[model samples]
Target: MRIEKEVSPEYEIPAVLQHIEARGRRPVLIFENVRNLNGTRSGLPVVINLFGARERLADALGTTVARLPLDYVAREKPLAPVVVDRAAAPVKQVVRTGADADLYELPVLTHHEMDLGPYLTSPSVWVRDLETGWTNCGILRVYVSGPRQMVVNFNIARHTFHYFQKYKAAKRDVPIVLVMGHHPAFYLGAQTKLLADEPHIIGGVMGEPLELAPSETWGSDIMVPAAADIVVEAEMSHSQLEIEGPFGEYTQYYGGQKLSPVAQVRAITRRKDAMYLDIMPGRADHLLLDAPMVEAYLYNRLKDVVPGVTAVHMPVSGTARLHAYIQMRKTNDGEPRTAIASALSSDYRLKHVVVVDEDVNIFDDAQVLWAIATRSQWDRDLLVLPGMMGTTLDPSADDILTAKGGIDATRPIDPHQFAMKLCIPEAVLSRVRLEDYLTPEGLRRL
Candidate 1:
């Protein structure tokens, strides 16, 4: 319940519901207990780092995994926020300037044993492209090295990569905003795959707009909540690079320490009552962010590719990013392969995607495997493509390339003598319940 008081009404209940949905394995909510990292000043305890199970992610999005992708079709584009003054901002309720703004004092977590230092794992960095005037909001890892220095890891293909490339090409340092400790909805909005700039998707999802405020230290660009718990205004020098790695990653493996660009913090603005949110780099954090996003994007990508495309399930074991289970109506014979091709091309992140019939629950891997066993012939259903691009965190992909494979697990209809096809009666399935053996509580040796 620590999150209830500090978080908005929408975030609080869903956070708790995340636990309920997972039953036992869901992410645990941290209650407030601020410990100052400097041994002198401490941050206020706040709830943070919620993720892992599908139920947990579903809670964050306020929907089930099954429905999330369809929601993207709604495409509620957020309007660029109107900037407000610092005095009017609740985030400035307690402002720390220059050295007083030392980030070392915040209780940032050093997630993996090999991490260079304490890192800000979950952040929605807001910046603008120089030539295009396009505002960017996306997630990247930030490692705290000094009071004013943090290391940034930008994937070669990420928006940050393009932005950084621009700066590097011009030999100019780029200044940007790093925001944390706000609504989970903000994180959801940042996951969007659209090429356009949108901070207003939060408003559309919430049925209203989110309030934003300008940074006292930086100009124009508004940070989240109009009162974010912690905001860092940072500049990145394209020429001045540093090694930024050996950190654990979403891929569930060590990213093995990387030498990357450094973020020079110019000024940090925060609430006196700020509670730093520490998201562990791997596992849970990766799941919550990846699952719902994959569910939404894959569905959107494969919808028109295969008719009767109903749901996309990114099970927890697949890291929710690497593997996807696609469900569709098999209107024709080659439909599954078509769905697989579209899905693979949709996002560079997906390594393997399987398309199954409506009878199989995409969410349950067991049923999917069952369909593969009963309905598919190895040669007929399997499709493997050579030399595909891999995601940044896909350690298995070697950063350069990897192979792609998919299975068509739906039962094939007979082209001839189809009238003899058989199935169980719906009424029998609905009415027959073996309470004596099937139910755990019903089974007793005595």
Candidate 2:
């Protein structure tokens, strides 16, 4: 939807999206008349909530929502990138170097009411290892501090931080390229857990080779996606640190202010008519971007320890990072505990895991809750590990350590050993049609 009416980048865009979410709709919004941070109408349009719904992501991957995780896992193999000339790269159409590269020309958004200032919410930062030359890609938050400078928040556990450490140890600046506004597959591929060149993985997810173009700043040594709408070439300082954030995060809470690495913007390049993309932080758009990737990773990990694992879900209620629900066809009582341990160890951000039987619909909150209430006994089914390393973003964590807990909400394998669940006969359920039974008015009311 295109909004012809003028909208301020600060809070107004997010406020409109929040109201739409309350009404149970998430649509891609295009603000044609968005005011820049400098209070001038931006020539480029602003796109928000592009990946707000799971169905849209699935559609982008050419699959149904139910099959998204498995599909991602199956197609996540590495495929090399094909390089293209500058003339063929749309992002190189308009290049600005040094002082001419003004960030305020774009509509950078201030998402929440308390945000420090305008932020670039959808940057996929790319950096390469000095020794192995393996490139790492990560979607990181950037605070727009000035026209030529920005502060980047990098998680210590992530590869970007690891590469930054190597650069810092050598007292050398880290060469970085921030790619913005590409196909959803480009971002999805960057979420791979594998430690390899990410452009190849991006190609795999896109089902075609990712086209690369030599960077104007670093030339052939560093390449940017040829099809990206905007690409910012910058260098991360080795010794410089700046105060960044009190910014809204994926956990639906504000991350406290801390010193973070500063990036000096050297050049900016984009398509002639680039669209500024912003994800609604602490909302479905931010959380769901990583949900399917995490689910697929966990599902693959659980299969090694528990072969009967049927499905995995990271519910939105848990902010898609804190809680996980695993569905499995249990052969023995020990599998649930094993799955929990494997899952909890796989990611530091996960705090809780609930293992349920295959009969339970793990996607439905009510059914999963019912399984927990009916089948789990705290004394027998609960598993807790204290003082585990976890993300500090978790508000409940004590510094970098937090407790991890899990529940085995599965009944015995033998059906006759436990009380039978209430269910309608399959024959009757299959025959009954709600559309046939209900009147038009009744259906409309529903």
Candidate 3:
């Protein structure tokens, strides 16, 4: 989570990529003097790829990448956020209202060729439920539309969309706060799907309780992270809507233009020198950021039905959302099939699920594929569910309904005829060190 600040005279998307390449693919980069669309320098700095690398993400969570899901599940309880005085909040150092509330001044990036315009790629939106008064936060996409207006797209199934629906029914503007640049834990927490608890509680579980500050325009009930680099206090118009996309998504495809809710900015608050965070669409950072949360959710759900469930992996190849791999210890013959069905049901976005024994490493794509090749019988082990509700982002789906399938890659439980994988003896393998016999060049080649 350590960021390297660059004192560049000008900032652009290409320059950010160049900086990443120069640093040999470093995770985080903070750029000062970000250039606007007119090629004029802006006062605000921009932070990109903050959670790009797995090692950096692991460091942020205080655990190794392999242990992130288990750790997250263990600490997935609600811890109330602490409200701090506006005078003590770093984000309240400078307040821009009325004429100064201009979204164009920030360095929003046009990430792809077909993008509609510059987009705020890393804003975690905060909204309150109209019926329950419970606060909800989600990392949703925002397209910059004007000086004080932006289009916020929400999936119909997401909780944020549900809250917006309530406001739409009541015919009132839904107050919202767009939080940018806080701890990586906050970003990960925003993606978590909690039924009872709020998202900010995940931050408290990870490290400390998130410090809250009342939004200047949205009243005291609408809270934002006090330590955030930037906060956009806005309200979503219940009746007014606009066409918002053709922007790149995590699925590596352009989400076609659609009418989305518009949020008109009432105020913009930030520190004297704020860092605006941006995430690249359809990239590793976008995928892995939500992967651990999804895995933890599936693990929690599956453990209740299948007691032997051990691990869940949503590989990056599946965009870390649409495909799943479940590893479990099979006590009976029907367990693998049940696990496969349960996995597909657990996440509606999942189109393909593969259940394997604990012996296979789900993280390794090759090993999982190998298990399917050797352990699965196409006719007997495959289960297909047709005309199921699928993700809207899936290009192949017809009207968001598609046929999904699962593969039970676990070996037969009766005879146990699968051949054992050959490996060198543990004692001998542990004793051998390349430095003892090989040259540096030879070791590198090996």
Model 3 off-target regions past 4 Å?
Answer: 1-26, 196-200, 414-416, 435-446
How far out, in Å, is residue 441 in model 2? 7.1
Question: Between the candidate structures 2 and 3, which one is better when assessed by TM-score?
Answer: 2
How does candidate 1 fare on TM-score?
Answer: 0.84
lDDT of 2 by residue, 189-295 (tens): 88887888998999999999999999988999999999999999999999999999899988888999989999999999999989999988999999999999999
Off by over 4 Å in 2: 438-446
Q: Which model, 1 or 2, shows the larger TM-score? A: 2
User: Which predicted model would earn the best lDDT?
Assistant: 2
A best-first ranking of the candidates according to their TM-score comes to 2, 3, 1
- Pairs with steric clashes in candidate 2: none
- Model 3 accuracy (lDDT, Cα): 0.82
Compared with the true structure, what per-residue lDDT tens digits does model 3 show for residues 320-346? 998999999889979888888888887
Among these predicted structures, which one has the highest TM-score? 2
Put down candidate 1 lDDT per residue, 1-446, tens digits, no spaces.
Answer: 35433332113333444455465445455645434446442546644546545555555557765666556446447655556677877677876666677877665665555667667777778767878766677777887888778888777667878877888899988877887777666666776666666566655554456667866565555354575777888887788778887777777687766678887777777777776665655556556665665677667667766657888887767877778888877777788888888888787777888778777887787888877777677788898987998775776676668888888877665547222336799998888777834756555532
Candidates in order, TM-scores: namely 0.84, 0.95, 0.91
- Local distance difference test, each candidate: 0.69, 0.92, 0.82
